[model samples]
Target: MSQNAAAATAGPVSPDDVAGLRAAVTGPVLDPADAAYAAECATYNLAQPTAPAVVVGATSAEDVAHAVTFATRHGLAVAVKNAGHQVVPSVGESSLLITTTRLTGVEVDESARTLRVGAGVRWHEALAAAAKAGLAPLAGSTPGVGVVGYTLGGGLSPLLGRAHGYAADHVRWIEVVTADGVIRTVTPDDEPELFWALLGGKGNFGVVTRIEFTAVELTAFYGGGLWFPGEDMAEVLEVWRTWAPALPETASTSFAVQRLPQDDALPAPLRGAFVLHVRFSHLGDAAEAEELLAPLRAAGTPVLDSIAPRPVPDIGAIHVDPVDPLPYVETGFGLREFSVETLAALVEAVGPGSDCPLVTVEVRALGGALDREPGTPNAVPSRGLPYVTFAFGVAAPPDLPFMDEHLAKYAAALSPWTDPRNVVNFIAPDEAVSEAEVRRLYGAERYHRLAAAKRRWDPDNVFRRNHNIRPSSAPAGD
Candidate 1:
């Protein structure tokens, strides 16, 4: 049996084990008793907690390998964290967490139109580097999110997705350290199965050290936010439902039903307000975008209009996601279609008079290139999904019942239109998905393929934390 298989009898992680890891790694290795352990494991979402027996702050791929090898020898499962936006709380699980916050690096090839980033690099860092090269990557809404983790979960760029497809679809290469503690450079041409699986399998396969992906040629785009009064939500949504579907591939849109806090940091109009925020990003000139946006703009007068021509780095302003760590309950899933019925259901669930405690209920239209297959196919299951919905409720662990009740109600309201496929990044940190649900999420064929790859690379399942994709030897459904 593998060392990981014999781990149950290995007892608790000892001080000597932590000391050995600290000596082997170039970065810090802290246990629960260490003074710096909590901060080392800090995540973007303060609500999601972790309790690793030992924390390995990996500075390089070699450090990651050493950590992984040590975890295997000690029979400890490995959990990885970088930006920690999608952290799955350790709770009762005993594992060694590898923190990749120290592996920051960025490089752009203007001639090749590709970018290389360390696993620790955030989207903002990469965006700035690519902006200097007159190019842009397919980054997600929050710039604070780590590039490697997001891309692995099929990075959906609010600005580029409709035209360019998912960030995973454009990936050219991946550098990962597998369960066996060997760092490998993976691509479609080399280690094809591992490449396909890692792009979507997440931490189940191994810890990705670095990645290289293609970037678009353009730098600037016409895009921004438009917030409307909460009372006029139905009216604005009706116009948007029809207007957004007719948009060209060059344009993308989504709307959020926000219950903003009365924070001093917020703008005057949005502070302590319930409003509908419509986000638009178009790869076109101002005149053309304005013409396309006429209907929604004319819908019951917007309270705030910040839409304009902005540089690639300013893309985060479109969603305006919180940068600091805060307690919140978040989850997302795909939608087969957002018909009139779906819109009505949404309005009834979180409209003006509703008592919904969720901070933001968002729906993004997905189609155009997003539905099509890229040159080299990947494991992204949401390809044909017409829409993707994300929602979050501001609440700490003690307030779980309050947040969870409304979240459940909101989900039930849209259950009729819910699709099984979802972006891995958008999954809830606390979600406990069944094996059958996971199979359905990826579809039987794809899940089987991923499981087979996991069997090959990590048969012992050393990396079982996060949204685990088990290295099952049986068939997909079995």
Candidate 2:
């Protein structure tokens, strides 16, 4: 073994050795003792905090490669963070965290109608940059989410997804630093399998430093969110269950049962309220969109309504996801279909008198382009799924028992419609961790192919932080 490898194996990395890493990289190499460590490791999801022995605040792709090289030499596992929206819980001291927040770059190719952004670029940033050129990327429900991570995990845009498919479907290329410390520009012609796995496989393949995707020609939309009293959930949802599925490819819809907080962040009408939020988006004339939305609108009284034609940048107005970190447990799974029975089940679980304890339970209608395949094939697992449900509850210590029980109950109640595979982005931190669970997520054939790619690109399983796809050569149970 080399000097560095032997030295690393003997014990924890010595101060002098860490110093060597700091000197090699063009970024801050922080340790727990460093005064800036805590701030550097903060996460958007307070429920799953990140704690790593070492953190590299990478400024560029070269810095990321250096950090990966440093971690591999020390036989340490690797984890990555950009916006820290979905941070993975660190295993222990043997892991190195690479924070890509410093690599904020956004470039719009007006002629080609494409967007290229650094890993740190959020959807809002991409949306703003693309708008200046009359194009748009498939940004998610929340504008604050990082573009790279969201697209890699098959980003589901609440406004445009049903019309244009997943964000992963439009990726033109990806710039990633693999476990071997190599910076590679992956494309369909040049690393097909790697490209396929990276798109829908989440973070299993490598740490993506930058990504580029074709943009849509959208400048505005005819939709926003509406909030109705919780008591009207059953009635509104009844109309939605049948109405949403029949929406044209130019339209998309979703609704959530929310027991909101009394925080100042929420609007006056929504603060400390129990309400049903109905979100809609249509790439069509305002009159036509309004005609399509008439049935659901007339079903119940809307306490807050903003469904109107707005600029594309206001796409986030459809969901209005929280802008601040809050302690919560999130889990989601796709549904084969949302039939009348499924609606009945949901009503039984969280309707008017159900006394559901969860803060949010959202069901988005999925069909149209979302149910179809992209031009080039990718590993996105949830294609063809008719609907997907995302549920989350607060995770305070005192609320653990009730929350856990209720969450399980909610999942069990919807099991009849549950498809084994899910949208990769919504898989919870504590979920799909086991090998069998991950296999079940991608299905046997797809997971095996993903495993083959994992074997080629990350045989040692260095990047096992997110919803890990183990290499086929590894022990089955791992």
Candidate 3:
């Protein structure tokens, strides 16, 4: 073994030792003194601070393997950051960070309708590349999110999700470097176990280096937004629930009730007061899409209507999720069915009459594409929930405690309707749900197997920042 490796094994390697290790890797190595360290650590979401003991700007898979080897040898923790949208804190504390942002590249095979993307490439980057070949992947509303992170977390896309399914359903293969510092190519045919684990498994199994997936031929959607006045809350919620399920598979929609902060950047009508914003996307023609959405559109005289035939990349404008980073507290639950009674309860809790001045209340219909089994053999616990509803609480100066209380009450009120199954993407840090709740999110059999997989792949519990599954031998209730 080398002197640096021996020294690392003995104790925490000093800064000089880290420099020696950096000399071995091909990528840019950053320490505290590095001028670009702060900028490099900043995420797109801007909420997360990527303060790492060491940051490796991985330009290739080989570079990642080197970082992994170095981290494992020194008994250091590791965090893989791409777009940094998952702003949960302490995620990258005193650990070695492998930032994949520089690895942004995309390649498309037109005839195969498949695209291979670098781990750091964002959805918009891949979409632009795929569009050249008249193909598109099942991208989410915000195209700025990294492809590897979103898809690995069971990507919930806006394009034809009902008819097709989640973005994870279309994955062809992935290249990952395991915690043991071994580089492996994962496909359903090759390492079926790792392949299944990597999909919807978050960053538990390994650091994904490359992702290959099939794309859709879609160019445009008969989609856009419908805005309603604050007074139409009761009528709009009831009308949306009744009319939403009846719509065909070619359609997907979300109802967002929010009080847009007064800003000169936004239109006057939507600036201050609460508003019911209904956003929809259809696979077919513009006119038929309009007619199908007419009733909901006519539910209330709109303050603003931007609904029309537009490019897929522009879909983020429909929900118009706040681009700026602000302290946010969110809670979400998937329901088997949002019955009329339950809808009424929700309307009372966070709707127009409620004192909750929320940032947004979003309800996404999750049956079509998200309901089906993924192409790869993975342990995606089926929650059997038809709709997933969430409350994003963003207050001035960000009231963490109040936000938590409000969301807990909201989840409790809907407990009767909520299915235990959780999409890993929606799992937040402050959730007080029990182990039984987690078991409910992921079925009994699958959760057990995932725990088993964790035992085999990551025995020491190195990657426990995510929704963790403890090993069987670890004392239960200790």
Candidate 4:
């Protein structure tokens, strides 16, 4: 028998009983010898990668359940990773890391317009499946993120969320493994309160194994980016702020300030300089889409323009989020309105005059379809914001102080229109944005109700990671 097997047979499982549990798991139970162990644990931001005691390569839902049960039995903390894109380093040291990179499954129901996806499934997989059935889900700008993780955090898709609300709003059901090692299927119809809390409440309640959500009848869209020189960003942004909210449900847009490396990978005009990109996703006829976007496109000398009808899967090319891993910090706030004054302030903060070599500053317009309340049970409560602003700083060195200063200036500039509350998913792991901020973003009533439900289902606080939902103090024990 292996050392792990011998340890198991010895009996009396202690806090040092991981070797024994490793003996039981069928897949490769890693302990640093695995070459990809370090790389696998490295997240998208690439700043931190916790050294877990054992990395469990889960092959199926049963495998996931086994890993969870084993961790609980052995008194070992556990973390679930899919695509390892967690902006926050939730997975920590000596933990049993359940790597669900193998569960690739998708079942589409055309009549119901829903797709049941495995926890490991990526956006590209779902996008292709939906497109085949003349349907689409609210997917993020990039198609590389895991479906379950993103949806559970309330996915904001590029396909005009204003008309569809959030990706979480469409979820019909979820299969999860609780801390006590029970696999349960939850839906609004079944566990109504649990269902409501898990949608936007993050991974505090349980480990979501599968996701089922609605898809729209969209195969292609009038989507692309129009680039302008740095000098003209001011005029272009002003036009975007004035026109974006007035846009119909068929139109979704954002203004972006980007500094691209002079490389062949980037389009010719966007290379080697600070540029303004007005990204668009329109569902209307080509002629009408052009007519609506003419004012802003006409505002400056066009360096590059690629707005045209394209399949939805290729939408990543527009935002062009870095595919390669690098250290980065993301901080954002929701704006009540992106007025002309607000636009000017933002331009001054991160535009041409700014010293930051930031990857991008984006202002996503969010009123049309996104503002409407969903009839479903979920937790993306910030509906009043006309725009959501984000700053992604990539050039900051390890242990850099300049990053803090840049973010401070950017925050100060937009302070007038900014909401005190911000999304939990966007905050850096190191920064303390405060629970009060989260409550403000989620609202007192919803936060309170979510806390209550969290207590009922996860009173022991076993599943605590991601944007954690703390149990209420009323019930100390179940």
On residues 1-478, what C-alpha lDDT tens digit does candidate 3 reach at each position?
A: 4332242344565788689768987778887779988876775433335677778889888889899877767756667887736543354434678888877779899999999999989888888888778787988778777889888878777656787787787898899988777788888898787788778777767789899999888777777787888678788878888788888888888888787888888878788868888888888998889889988976788888887887766667666666666766787777778778888887888776687766787788777656767655566664356887878777543456686778777887788888777666777654623456655567788777777776777665445445555555532211
Write one digit per residue (lDDT tens) for candidate 2, span 1-478. 3333342454576789789989999989999899999888888877666778799999999999998888777877789887847667554588889988899989999999999899988888899999999887899989999999899999998778888899999998999999888999999999999999999998888999999899999898988888999988888888898899788999999999999988887889999999999999999999999899999888999999988888888888999888888877777898888888898899899877897889999998888888788998899999888888998888675666677678788899999989986898888888898899989989999999999998888877778877888886543321
Question: Which lDDT value does model 3 have at 374?
Answer: 62
Tell me the tens digit of each residue's lDDT in model 4 across 92-131: 5535687767777989999999999998899989889888
> Once superposed on the true structure, which residue ranges of model 1 sit more than 4 Å away at CA?
91-93, 473-478
Worst 10 residues of 1 by lDDT: 469-478
Q: What are the clashing pairs of model 3?
A: 165-369, 420-440, 420-441, 421-441
* Top TM-score hit: 1
* TM-score order of candidates, top first: 1, 2, 3, 4
Task: Flag clash pairs in model 1.
Answer: none
Task: Say which candidate scores most in lDDT.
Answer: 1
After aligning candidate 4 to the native by TM-score, how far in Å is the CA of 371 from where it should be?
1.3
**Candidate 1 global CA lDDT score:** 0.87
Instruction: Give the CA lDDT, 0 to 100, for residue 256 in model 2.
Output: 95
| lDDT score for residue 312 of model 3 | 65
What is the lDDT, from 0 to 100, of the residue 240 in candidate 1? 91
TM-scores, all models, native as reference: 0.97, 0.96, 0.92, 0.91
Local distance difference test scores for all models: 0.87, 0.86, 0.75, 0.73
Per-model C-alpha RMSD:
2.0, 2.1, 3.2, 4.7
Q: Is candidate 1 or 2 superior in TM-score?
A: 1
What TM-score does model 4 achieve against the real structure? 0.91
